[model samples]
Target chain A: MVSIRDVAKAAGVSTATVARVLNGGTPVSPDRTERVLRAVQELDYVSNGVAASLSRGRTGLLGLLVSDIANPFTAQVARGLEDEAVRHGYQVLIASSDFDSEREAQVLASFARRTVDAVALLSSSGVGEGVARLIRNGIPTVFVDRRPPDLGEIPLVRTDSLSAAREAVRYLIDLGHTDLGMISGPAGMPTAAQRLAGFREACATAGLVVRPKCVREGFLGTQGGYTAMCEVLDLPVRPTAVFSFNNVLAIGALEAVRERDVRIPADLSLVTFDDTDLFPFVDPPITAIEQPAYDIGAEAGKLLFARIDGAETAGTDVVLPTRFHVRGSCDRPGR
Target chain B: MVSIRDVAKAAGVSTATVARVLNGGTPVSPDRTERVLRAVQELDYVSNGVAASLSRGRTGLLGLLVSDIANPFTAQVARGLEDEAVRHGYQVLIASSDFDSEREAQVLASFARRTVDAVALLSSSGVGEGVARLIRNGIPTVFVDRRPPDLGEIPLVRTDSLSAAREAVRYLIDLGHTDLGMISGPAGMPTAAQRLAGFREACATAGLVVRPKCVREGFLGTQGGYTAMCEVLDLPVRPTAVFSFNNVLAIGALEAVRERDVRIPADLSLVTFDDTDLFPFVDPPITAIEQPAYDIGAEAGKLLFARIDGAETAGTDVVLPTRFHVRGSCDRPGR
Candidate 1:
């Protein structure tokens, strides 16, 4: 309960001097700054961040809500966003929604309660009603990775998942994969729908009919991928090649392939999205479409700062490019 | 600029009703709550989180600072901690220090300025001076994974790295390997020091002369591990087996080994710490001492909440057990 007045009195300095020292940036004599710090420590004066931020009209804190922090793609995006946040002298508070819209709403509410200066929401799932609340509260928000239709005018920074998926599917088709299967993300996620659309588009362009049984939707996790792959393998007419929505799914599919003693590329071709470091080292070096995850995050941060700074970027959508790494995981269907 | 009074007036309700609707917990008539929310939206009444928190004397926020969020171990730990935080109606803010003590200090200072309810620091490097400032300001903190000597009387939740390292080395020795090289973490990290000590202790117990050239320090990253492994490989007499301090380093060392066309188990045996899911599927599946990363994080969260709730658990260290998974990575080395 020690106040700034006590510290100012003990330091023999004015309240302004203590505030200047604590908040930094202002020019203060080194001697006075040292004395103020010493007094703060000796008197155990804890500055009320709430009171200070209230008066200043800025908290210097950004709230980031990611779908899953454990996912490498999201994690890298977070790192990129944090790097930008730190560069701008802002502290970011991160919370994971775990792909649940309810949890996303709760997290947004919590962020609001904390009064973060602005928020960046990264979710493949649909944007929830909490977003409307945040917008109504006049908090600046930027969507990263996925921008649902409902979020009509919110600024977004993301890679073009549809085109990337089409490119990956085209690559598989070029490998003579007419009987191709796909493991997609959750049903409601925009990214999942876009990727699925791309897959069908590519198949149609090649004059090939994608069998209904060959397409499966999985949760955005390895376990989900595994179960989906198992279902595909259990089919009477197995696919000669598979394109997974993301790296985690690809890995789970790989596990199922390995478990069933199916040789990669030789028995079944494979391609996945979001290439990670492990892709290059895996037994048959996975063929992958690498999204500019870090760049997307950084751009999201940039757009968010612009919004917070009162820029007119409400409808801005900064789409970065994706790279396809042609490795040994893809080949002409041998079966 | 819209205030609670404006919202209440618009909704035909009291300011207390608006506050209750916004804050939750208090059961009010559904109609009244709906009206208040509509008025808030219509008026764009953003709640002053700082002012509310100052009056209530609690922010319901916990800050977590980890060495590296990109690392899978730390990422999982974060997920675990956040799970516990959400379960207890608290939100977590995460920051990565990137193993720099200076950055760690900056993060801590920023956390203090944000006035988080409590903090948990997970660093393998060293804790810096900002800790003292936080402690002086009456912020409760608990150390996770590594507790430096300077952090006396601070509670810790970590696995017994020394015993785990000793066990790993002994297991390698049991496979009849005499010359064992080690890739350790940073020079001054407590966990690094303990693991190195355990390596040396095991060698001493086996009556083997420890060669200085056989031990190398890595920066707790893949690139550092690669460089260190390359250096070890360039030695005049290569060891029969190698122990990497963590999975990241082991993967880096594996890359170096693969680049040189060195066969595993036949040419050299490998053991590592912190078993990740990738370890089981890698070629010649690695032998590893798996630290209970998630459990450690959960325990740390439990301890942090205990401190926040006014429990007397300071000076306590919660030591979790490490599981040894012996896979195909080790054997009688035929060098």
Candidate 2:
């Protein structure tokens, strides 16, 4: 029920000053800006300002395709993309592929038919063919999260999965976990390949012998993690520590450990590749590498917009850094 | 990389049959449909069909405005909506309102400017004015999750927050928790109002004291929940239990409880209004009312499409059921 007038009155500012703060293109004084913002938040006043006139023939629509929306990581990336796209006067039409490569291709084709101004793909697995088609058609596309192996000149916005993975592995090794195990995605996917590379490099560098049984193939899915974890648990020599390469895997691995009566950081240590709010709330708060999904999304949107604006330089790969959030899950590995 | 020909060959169907199965124009027999689907899944084939030549003059875009995308519940709803929309040969342009009514209005206006065919307004706190404007503008709008009070005959697709909330509160009281508190969203918001109504009605029916101190105002935000939980913990007679009516609030409430060393289900029983996959992994996995968000989304998409297809009828309010998922968090009240 609160209006701009009410906000203006509350802040002792004019309606124009309030408008200037709410919408860009006009500027207000520092004190006025602060007062207007505070008044807006206090009054919960939403401006009915229409977006600046969109460029003609530009539908002002961008296409975003992800493997899954239910995944917290993917959803966060999507939030970042949607927020940034809206800021640039573009609305995003998001499609989920459910990790199905074919569905991914179909979604892209649908986007093409809709004639979106540009596209942002989040770390595709089986959809490289669809992406190739997009590139062949000359549509502005930005790869996010994971890039295709042969995407020679495509701009990519991804987190440093390799270094983060390596550091996490190294951290576990430092904690005296010589016999460590990893639950990883299918070996063929680019993100999976990079993560696996990190795991191998870290183990090899630390003079730790990573037997073939210690590395289990997973689909980056909960069930995949459960099955893989069970395999590791049934091995003759139980791993002193486990590093799940993604969120769902971590969840499944934890469930397996719980089922087996294995205590985290006591009987075994744990490290997960991705982090979520849930991690902090869980028992033995999980140690994880926080993938900055939002930043990747924001950066992808910026790159896509730049291409739409006719940025003609070769593709720029924006590799955002990852951070390690250590909690009670990882500790010294007892004999 | 799998082509229609390959799928047809693998499934022992003609190319036309494969096309008919993937695209909805012509219905294929059950046997052929099964074969085609299996072939598609096995081969990882994605049909690049351009959505069955959508009706000319139809923009083939539906606008979905939600309060938050980062929220798991919202994200799941979005996934369901996107999947259903895709099946119907439409794509969704999603915008997050961040529970701000003003931003909701602006996003609707932008959707209008872009000529999206119809819209699905997800549960939100502050955008009735914008929604009303859309209704007046005669753009097909289906209110999702939260419907505006006094809005004449606006179709709504929502989970039953009222009955479910009442039952949850009553369930706790049945276990002998005479004292109770609730973390509720801001007043005057439709969803918040409904939930609060349920809480009050339940307490009154049970002859429990409905003191103002038992109710804490929150924004359905993490900070809101944190502040409200702090207040509730400081209450002279802290309630035997607390029900956080939303996800973030529940998280904040749990954190506060943990900080205070309040043993869940022993010192204080806890119940949250929504469920996420993360709940189970946490210690004393949260007991929650699981809102079937995917069904709501899928149904909303169907309704919007029906409206778009010119189904003239009175507004339909489809209220889905909510199921209680009790974990280790809720039990008999103890000293």
Candidate 3:
């Protein structure tokens, strides 16, 4: 509650002198500046952000929107974004839409109303049009983990989902598994579609047919994966190997197999996408496609800051690569 | 970019008419309100937050400070806070201090300067005085996860760490283990202290001696846990049972034990604090204390909003319970 007048009174100086010292206006005598600083600290004077922001026409706040905050993958990316944003002297305002397009739009509109300096969106459910409107209104936006089809000139950071899926499938294939099934995320998601495309491409290149009955699409949570795995297990010719599009799906599949008393590798080989630090501890350590989630988040943050700093050029897209980690889960089929 | 004037002109109404329609002040003719709404949609007009805030003397922005964001426990809590804040018509700005008191102070100052309506802090490093100052300045402040000493009448939401730790240790003792080791978090953290106290109490009640060499203190991360486990393994009388303060430590111990080729439960029973969804998938599913992190976050957020809504006697501490989940990691000795 210390005002400039209080600091001035404590420092034996005029209010104008204190203001000058604080704002660096017309270089004050060094001794006087020191006295004012001491008084300010002693009084615990805090600047009024409303007055400062009104004078400057901008606040040091950036908005971040994600599809779901509970997902480990999104949470990791958010951590990276927050770390980078803090380092750059910006604060992040976060909102989650639960993968609903209308909710995503509402969140974006809210951010726009707040007039955040920039926005970082992880819009897996395709709310590009809402983002386009923000860009048109001169709000800098950077998409993370999900890229829009027509966002050719907008800034985006995403993992190479197609390549990651291909590598994951290839790892299982290399382990001498022929009968393969896939548990994909919701069909409308770009990342899921890309992964499925990669899986089919890998199968075709290996002279194998991707059976229609071997794929199921649903939510990306553990239950979704569980239900998908159950469907796959019901097939007369159940696959000896399976590639799950995300970590939650892989976990669900693992649970299903364990409940059914199926021994890993001997009965089934599994590979998952989007590996995290926790995966190594799984029963039989899962072989997984590890994307650069942290890197993608950091890069997206950097890009958004650049745009906020008046980079007028159309933003570019960045696709980080994935690493295939081979572990206890993906062994030779029937080993 | 569209202003009220532009909307009024486009809608063929006076500016005051447009303003009335937007603010719902007075009964605007329904036809005129419709026209104004149509013009706003067509022009894609976004409200100017700066102008509105300046006029109202408040911004609908809340600040959230966390010691660490990458930790699954912290991340889940953050998700709950975000969900509740959004529902209550507030936006959350987040900062991570990595348990550094200085960094936390800086973030608090920054949030104060941004004129945030309130702040919710997950202060694991114990610096409540700074936040108390903000509250004195009329900024509503709420603490989560870690309670600071003498936060006289300030609000806080935390889990029952003492009881949780007691349950974990008692579970190990019931399995017929006497020689116990513990991996504690940094010395000053209240949660760590409470858990340690609970562990000692359990030992005393069970007539077991506490060995000084069996306790290690550091950040609750994988590396810290791994190094602590190494030290415990080197002890002349290695513990038959171990309790980790968090999941990161549990994971680190898992890797260390794997490297040492020591079998879990059979050689050393282990229980960790803060159960995560990932635990169930682990090779030997980790036994853990499940803190109600999401509830704590949601409650803190709700308390903050209640304070903001002019609650006369708002600052109250809320403590939730933790549940013990026994899994494969803790079993009868020599299983």
Specify the highest-lDDT model's number. 1
lDDT of 1 at A139: 81
Q: Write the per-residue lDDT of candidate 3 for residues A1-335, one digit (tens) a residue.
A: 66778999999999889878887858899899999999988988887777667667777777888876767787778778877887787767777786667878877877776457788888667676678778778888887887677776777788888877887787777777777899998987888999999998888778787788898885867888888988888788888888898987887877788787888777888888888787887878888888787788888888878777787647587878878888888778773
List model 2 lDDT by residue over B1-335, tens digit each.
Answer: 45789999999999989988987689899999999999987876654322222223356778888888888888878878888888887777788877777777778777554356788887566565666666655668887888767774978888888888899999888888888899998786677788888887888899988778978988767888888988998888888888888987888887788788888888888888889877987887888999999988888888888887789634798999999987888888886
Scoring only the second chain, what is candidate 1's TM-score?
Answer: 0.93
B-chain TM-scores per prediction: 0.93, 0.81, 0.92
lDDT tens digits, residues B1-102, model 1?
677889999999999999999879999999999999899878767777777877888777888998789898899889888889988988888988877777
Where is model 1 chain A poorest over a 10-residue stretch in terms of lDDT? Answer: A106-115
Question: Best candidate, DockQ-wise?
Answer: 3
B40-83 in candidate 3: lDDT tens per residue? 98998877777777677678777888866778788778878877
Error of 1 at A146 (Å): 0.8
Instruction: Compute the DockQ of candidate 1.
Output: 0.60
TM-score ranking from best candidate downward: 1, 3, 2
Q: Which runs in model 3 stand beyond 4 Å of their true positions?
A: A1-20, A23-26, A30-43, A312-315, B5-17, B313-315
In candidate 2, what are the lDDT values of residues A217-280, reduced to their tens digit? 8876788899999999989999999888898888888888889988888988889888988788
Tell me the tens digit of each residue's lDDT in model 1 across A1-335.
68889999999999999999987999999999999999987886767777777788877788998878888898889888888888898878888888777888888876665478889988655766778778767788888888778887988888888988998999889878899899988888788888999999999999999999899998878999999999998899899998899988887888898899888879888899888776776778888999888888888889888887788888898999999999888889886
Q: Pick the candidate with the highest TM-score.
A: 1
Q: Select the stronger candidate by TM-score from 1 and 2.
A: 1
Model 2 segments beyond 4 Å from truth? A1-55, B1-55
> Of all true interface contacts, what fraction is found in model 3?
0.78
